[model samples]
Target: MVSLAPYVLKRPWLTKMLTPAANWYASASGYRQLGLRYDDLLEEENEAVQIALKRLSAKEAYERVYRIRRSVQCSYTHKLLPKDQWTKPEEDVPYLRSILAQVEAELAEKDALDSMTVIKKH
Candidate 1:
């Protein structure tokens, strides 16, 4: 599956571009009152996720554990997508099937647009 997380992190400005439309409060959650910049938000989220991992107490079980927060960039991001939103992937956990479905749908759309170059060469 193609993950959008890396793309967003590489282009940090995308966060700024997305923020004007975001209803920031809900996005900030516990760190809401810090008055942090978008970059700072990454740090705050990383800390929270680290704490959660510690709570699990299984950090040593994995050679590497990385927690990445993707999706729901803003307070406006509410309401989970309906299961029917996705067509379903063959190898996907029932819990994660919706995510795979959404990503697959997006990849399909991008592929189609790229295929239609609209050119005629002699």
Candidate 2:
């Protein structure tokens, strides 16, 4: 709930100052080299993430599975994907983020409704 992300993102100067460092960290993380997007590395044990995964389009779901499988294969072999096959910076998008956000929002709404305290002001 408490994060500096929104504050930094809202300020153009702060975002500009951090963009290069963020990019550098992403590049250094090696998931791109394994052909996996940042979202692909998310923990599936989460309830909201499970809901989000179920909501993915069939094509997107297939690609997600393929990427995970390929990354697992690479891990087993102790090798990265070929340079050409490595995920480009532009291709490393957060495909699951929006869906996950939606799912989390819905869950939060459900919890609020379930715990509602209706006051009778007779």
Candidate 3:
């Protein structure tokens, strides 16, 4: 994946300029109003997501399910969560991203090991 996050983070000026825009975009995306974190928007069909879900603590997993169910209920009712109940910017952390990254790294490492050739040293 070619992410510009690293490049943006490397330049203090760019980070400063984009931070507010990014925050505004995230808020405008409406998931927060549904009380769902950014990580909850990730698709669940992939193996990495499955692994990441499994890696979540019981509380975190339950909370994730609750958010999804609540969001669905809101969708059905055509309503947004009350202001106080909305997911705060600070609360919209990337809970699954770290675990997903770890899973990807492990899969990559496994692939590397599997593709290794044995060299016999006499």
Candidate 4:
């Protein structure tokens, strides 16, 4: 999906104005309350995401798995984590996004190369 995120993020005033609404929306989305960072909720079925996940540092991968498992357990129990245990706003940084972007770029570049036509000049 195309997003205005980059555009809005580039403008200081827009970002400042939107930050609270974004935070509220995130909190209201309930994943953080379940102790899952936003990245933890990304769809793993995606090829780019799968590659990005594999590229994560061991510690980050472990932590991501732990968070997912903990969230799953919470889901079974029908309970949210205690407030202190909930993912904090700062802690909800997009750790996977950068890697995912890099993987996507690589895939696009590979596709471009694959589609290239080699023309012999006489």
TM-score of each: 0.23, 0.91, 0.91, 0.94
Q: Candidate 1 — what's its lDDT?
A: 0.40
Residue 13 accuracy (lDDT) in model 3: 100
User: Tens-digit lDDT track for model 4 on 1-122?
Assistant: 99999999899999999999999999999999988999998899999999999999999999999999999999999988999999999899999999999999999999999999999999
- Model 3 bad stretches (over 4 Å): 117-122
Write down the RMSD of all candidates, one decimal each: 17.4, 1.6, 1.7, 1.1
**Per-residue lDDT of 30-101 in model 1, one digit per residue for the tens?**
322222222223322444334433333355213112212212332246433344432222221132234334
Which of 2 and 3 is the better model by lDDT?
2
Clashing pairs in 2: none
Worst 10-residue lDDT window for candidate 1 reads: 61-70
> Which candidate has the highest TM-score of all?
4
In candidate 3 the C-alpha lDDT for residue 11 amounts to 100
Model 1 error, position 33 (Å): 44
Candidate 4 colliding pairs: none
How well does candidate 3 match the true structure in TM-score terms? 0.91
- Report the candidate with higher lDDT, 1 versus 2: 2
Model 2 residue 42 lDDT score:
91
